[model samples]
Target: MRLIATTWQPVWHETPLGWLDRYRAALAEVAADRDTLVVFPEYAALEAAFYGTVTLDARGWMQRGANHFDAYCDGIRALSKDTGATILGGSGFARKGDQIVNRALFCAPEGEAWLEKQMPTPYERALDMAPGEAMPILATRFGKIAAVICYDSEFPPIARRFAEAGAELLLVPSCTDTEQGASRVEIGCRARALEGQMIVAMAPLVGEVPGCEVIDVNLGQARIFCPPDGTSPEDGTLAQGPRNAPGFAILNTLSESLAQARKGTDVSVFAHWPESETPQNPPETRNFR
Candidate 1:
């Protein structure tokens, strides 16, 4: 399967229709000749809050995003139908009862699902955004997949469940306003790929939203990583895009290759993880101390 990830440069729009058109144009860039899945960055739907000339702070824009979330996703679902390719529509804030949650929407001609971030950053928590209690697995023609939203990618257990569920890839959609933040998420993505022995792709929101405090200055790149084994890239980087650029980083992989990787050229970290968890007495180390 051909996997495409983007470092999407956010643009301000005077109208929601203009934003939808912009999205369509972005998808047009792929020119896919075979089965493909395109991933956008986290908070990709936050641009929907830019539907007007007025500026809003993190809280205000998030609330606005919550309001327009469903409608904005409907627009993306239309694009999926039009293009016939599965898309991970980054993420957006949505009001679920009294709490607001950050969620990534996965849609294709066949089906659609919403995956939530089980971990919300401190900045997000300060704005009253709630952490999701569950992480749902997404299924597509490609295979079972997990969309690990932004900071949630930093956690091990979250990605492991998907890997255990037979997920071939973990799609990370992120947004970071600083170099430090960007590096952290990128490192997390690589670590997840190595530990899971599965392909992991990351796409982040780039560019600036001049008046929007939440996304004023963005930094990120599109990267695809795999286990550093003989079956895959030895250094774990399969593909990487120009930093903070508006473009796609593409990688192609087959199920057989992934199966072989898990079976082992040097080692099978994916299969051997269970042995690490078996209960045993702690090794004596008092003499070293």
Candidate 2:
């Protein structure tokens, strides 16, 4: 399957329609093929509010009004139908009764959608976002795919669990500011791919949000990770954004190329670790000398 990952600079705290126009235009440029999977950066839908916050508290920043949030979901549904593309709809503050959750939605062309991301980060906890209960791996025509949002990538066990559950591809959508944040996420993606013998794709928000101090410098780097054997040309990178602006990256073929790498016996690094029989003791005679 072809894949497109986007690094978008969202207008802080704007309406969903405003975000759609910008995102749709970017999508139009990258969505040349219908059989493409697109991943948008987390919180790009609420760029305005994210940037508008003088103090960054997760739950406190999101507007509780139902109309605004519902409109955002409505826009995602429309985009999936209109683009004929599968989307890893970036993270959003989803209201589920008395509390809100930091949720990511995965929407396919058939109008089927699944929600994931069971835990939130420390910052997210400050916002009082509720944690989810289950980790689901969706089986698609392309392959067995899993979804993870920002911060979730930091935990190796989370990625491992997905791989163990038969996920061959992992999709991550993130909203982060510092170079360290970007680098850490990138490293994790590569590590996960190497260990699981799977493909890992990350889409991060590029540029700054107005009010948030955490995003003083825009980090717009996004990438695709593949196995070390270099089985897929699409493995390296489909597209990349500018260091300081919004852009989209497209990989024309991902699934088939990844499968080719998985066919080899020596492809996985985790299989090659040296076994330890016992701890070696220091030589007493040598110490006396």
The lDDT leader among the candidates is 1
Among these predicted structures, which one has the highest TM-score? 1
The lDDT values for all models are 0.82, 0.67
TM-score list, all predictions: 0.93, 0.81
Candidate 2 deviant stretches above 4 angstroms: 12-16, 48-59, 64-67, 212-218, 230-239, 270-289
- lDDT tens digits by residue: candidate 1, 203-289: 998997787788788999999888888756668888888898788888776454456446655877888899888858766667765
List clash counts for every candidate, in order.
Answer: 0, 12
lDDT of 2 at 232: 49
The superposed Cα distance between candidate 2 and the true structure at residue 51, in angstroms, equals 12
Model 2, CA-based lDDT: 0.67
Q: After superposition, which runs of candidate 1 have C-alpha atoms over 4 Å from their true positions?
A: 32-34, 133-135, 254-257, 283-289
